[model samples]
Target: MKKILYLFLIFLHFSCADAQTFDGSWKGEVNVSGQKLLLVFNLKKDSNANWVGTFESPMQTSLKFPINTIKTHEDSISMDVKAIGLSYTGYLDRDKDVMKGVMKQGNFESAMILVRSENEQSGLSRKQDVFPPYDYIEQDVSFQNAKGNASLAGTLTYPKGGGSFSAVILVNGSGQQNRDSEVFGHRPFKVLADHLSKNGFAVLRYDDRGIGGSKGEVNLATTIDFASDANAAVDFLSKQQMVKTGKIGIIGHSEGALIAEIVAAENDKVNYIALLSGPVLKGDSLLILQSYALGKVAGLSEPALEANKLNNRKLYDILLRDEPPKVLAESLEKELIRQNNGNALTSDMKVKLSPMLIPWFKTFLRIDPAYYLKQVKVPVFASFGGKDIQVPANENIYALQRLHLNTTDVTIKDYPNLNHLFQNAQTGKIEEYFENQESFNEQLMDDLTKWLKLKTK
Candidate 1:
């Protein structure tokens, strides 16, 4: 379920000028499964002379966000992303013009170094991101998610000369994604939309309600709310003149794939659904698998891996309780301390466990995809990336295959070399996702469209 949409491993090193203050860009790299991922920290002094900054992994766009108020003592520096209970503590190596430390989150920590960034580039372009001379028609459109009080903005693409065609709504996975569903400069959604549009299938790729031109409040909403917006898109598509009646379907990736099932099962107008790198396991189960895979690749020792798993299972168990908010917070905090061998909860631990109390993470803990998948009484198509550590094909595909869906056309395929984003990958690590230039695989697009062509009106 990455953006699993949760874990972004940071192996950092601090590089900065030997200035009196930490007032510049810093960078580092952590090797995950033999892939290099770049990390950055941008620090500046506020009017109060307090140091504040943001943590960034340029390769993983979703990993960039502001850290908590930084506290420095003598030559020591510290910062935490309180929401996820992750923290960085370092001490200046003035002689070496660097800072050395560890990036800690959950039960894992990695050696960190920070150095001055020498004009690092942020925008990575892909070969398939080519513009103009398109053989299709593209239109900007918006629809009302009346129930959620939002407007869903998106691009509608279809064959230029096709009389009429079936329509498919593309849903984004985790994180705040636009219609392009871009990450690390890759616009797979745009590439996929164009491919489908040019191949006689109409594709509607939209911004998440609060993203891009769409309007809504995302902070308090969970997957259920997003499903409502998708249903609204279905309503809008059904009314389009070029769309065949009752021929609307949805194609979702990652968390979006789980969502597509929800919309399909509940919305009668949806004739079919296609899940691209979708997660079928329960949220907690998927996270467990994701953790093991990532830990293995990060070269975590066996004892450390097992300990982390034990902690996660305990955390999920605590999260699944339907107690009052106050009660849950106390219980969860206690569990965290106990998990830390009865030590008091650290500032980072408090920050990290805070997300577990939110609407989305809480809902994700116990919600089972089968509840919706079994209700989907329409054709289904699902594909997985053989190397997708986030939502590994072996785990999810097997889970999906075990389910006897309500419909018959339950087509599922696993591409041996693809990642969660459906790009051709070497190791399919986060590093690869940030480094690869291919937005999407052409061959997979063809296969997906070929399947979609038959499912459409």
Candidate 2:
């Protein structure tokens, strides 16, 4: 009888252990549009009754993510991870075996879900092949523009054969992006140039005016002013004996896309245009959308977000009224104080905001890419990433549809899993941007290659 009782106690102990426990690695998948991406959370319990883990993604080529803090109460748990330039937070299940919550960055938010992992496989499938290496030539040249004789600096990537070939000029979006538009340690323009050249197309990508080794001030320039620089690049390409001058095209990203539209409208020399994550709507609408994105990512309350939108609209109105920069700056400072609990403005924020508001607003208000896109007579290929928070895919497509351009000749492809920078992105806070290496959406590149082939034929 004593032996039987001891055995029964042992069985009860084992059953309790199995019933009260919740610990193990968890896996989840986020589906954006039609693209499926995998995410893994390796959760383990520590001595202090806390859970810890690491998040890994097969799509990220840079580094592994460490989960820093995890806290739990009776029926609720929270997890926090800090990687790159962003922070992620999520709420765990009552049993602590699953996580079903939202993730946040500075001003972005997304639904997050995790389940117990059954196997040790990594989150997403890895790519079997990588981009081929190619040789490149770096050059510094000057071009005549409406602003003056501005100096331009960039690298030219050519195929191994060295004969004249179809070429493309890369154009950057807004801000003071360098020739390569370096982001998160990735030079996308350089990468594209190398890829295209290896595939038999010559490529030229240069820094904008006042950036990198280029000469001039971009702060005083307008969208039309930038268009002149693109025209100069086209002129230079036209003169290059090593390039098929009539087959040269312009590939613009973001704000650069607007410039490409203007260039194609004014100059008939451009054979093709590729607009990557470009804006099709007026600048004011874009700003509102950007603000809304920021509000979501930042976790702003409904009231706070509405207030911010009102403030932004006020600033837009002031700018549209043509107020002097100083007056506008002062008004913005006052508004910022009100927004921030009456705190004084930081010098860095003030400096960054002052010169940026008037010039950018003026330029954005004056240029409507749709009008110019309607005038474009050449082939156009435009792409937008569905996960891109800065430029919403629906708005961009709607703008294109309104242009009523040759739908047959205009190609617009939306990659469901990509970001504004054309990278394969996971569903998370916008802060994930600074933490990952830049990657181009494979589908976008494939579509581009196919469209270019069709255009050249």
Candidate 3:
């Protein structure tokens, strides 16, 4: 999931090569896992003859990014996008119209090719994506999370000629997400909100704190803080003239599902709730499971994986103990050394691992969703994708089904071939997510709309 979280961040950091040999548009395709995405770099010589460049990926997003640190020598071209720990090394053709390269980010490598292209449109083929002239009312809105001292900006969509409609707030997963929960060039929440709005339900999708139009310090916030934001959304929506208090609900995805559990359990105004690719286990346990699952897909040997899991479990136990962060970081460093046979992790790895010591992850590592679910009394709908590697569907579905709920009603649905985003998928691998252009599965929209209509009525 972090990979998906960083994919766009890396894409945003770009660079070109020497002005002489690379002063033109260069288009390339990056094969990430099994998915292929197009990237374009348009480079030019500034007044000083130094190379300046901009990047575009029509298949990913329409935004163009300014890039730096482009270098070239003979037939070799390279760019260091240090912002996301990425480097691209390529060979230019004699005609200087094409550049073939390998992009390395962290430990992952992908083949990339850049050809000269000036007229390439956004190649993304999203059949379910909604465009302008919408039949529904769409408005940009902002609300206050008084407790968190944050202002959240979002889009509100509802049927134009509506009676008081049942409404749902769409909560995004982890990391810094905007209103649409954009990832890999696909806006899942936007597609979902469109569907639900068309089905006679108002939907609100907002940016996470400290992102986009929202205002706050996201790095200092935790899941509990995020719940407060959602609670505020509920409060705001309840006061809307077109929304009835008891008919407002939440649809939380991934980490947002956990926050929804917190909000739903504590707020009586929540009539119903939906969990999409939600976690059912404690954070530490889920991390171990996720590590093993994703590691296997990456062809990690069983013995090495078991060793890694064991080391992680021990570290998690240490994290829960009353120890200073300095001591814990030192201890973790020792553990990493032991796990890697005295090979120390790089400085970057240490920095990356710093999140494990943060207040958010520490709190998350201790959370038990079952504890929150047991307190919820609202109607609940939990869905999982069978091929979801991030949140394994069977474990989550089974855990949700087995919860000792005091809820009004509980419904669990499983999609055998869908990935975390509910796309009909081949391997349920994260890489496959970018390859498929379908935003949200049609069946998922139908099922969710049908359930919401029935529950609200």
C-alpha lDDT score of every prediction, in listed order: 0.75, 0.64, 0.75
TM-score (all chains, Cα) for each model:
0.77, 0.67, 0.78
For 93-142, candidate 1 gives per-residue lDDT tens digits of: 42223455677778767655665533444445588995878898889998
Candidate 3: tens digits of C-alpha lDDT, residues 1-457: 1222311111100112324366666665554533446676777889998777776667667787676678876566777665556677876532244455677779988655565544434365677777898989999999999899999999999999767899999998877677888765577899999889888999999988866788886656778999999999999889888886689999999888988999999998898999988899877788777766665664556975687678778878888887898998898778766755677676534643566777777777788889899998988889988888778887777777777789758888999999888899876655555457788888988998899999999
Tens digits of per-residue lDDT, candidate 2, 247-277, equal: 9899998888888998988787898999998
Could you give the candidate ranking by TM-score, starting with the highest?
3, 1, 2
If the candidates were sorted by their lDDT against the true structure, best first, what order would they fall in? 3, 1, 2
Candidate 3 CA-lDDT value: 0.75
lDDT of 1: 0.75
Clashing pairs in 2: 107-297, 107-298, 108-297, 108-298
Which 10 successive residues of model 2 have the least lDDT summed?
Answer: 5-14
Question: Residue 236 of model 2: what lDDT?
Answer: 82
Tell how far residue 373 is off in model 1, in angstroms. 1.0
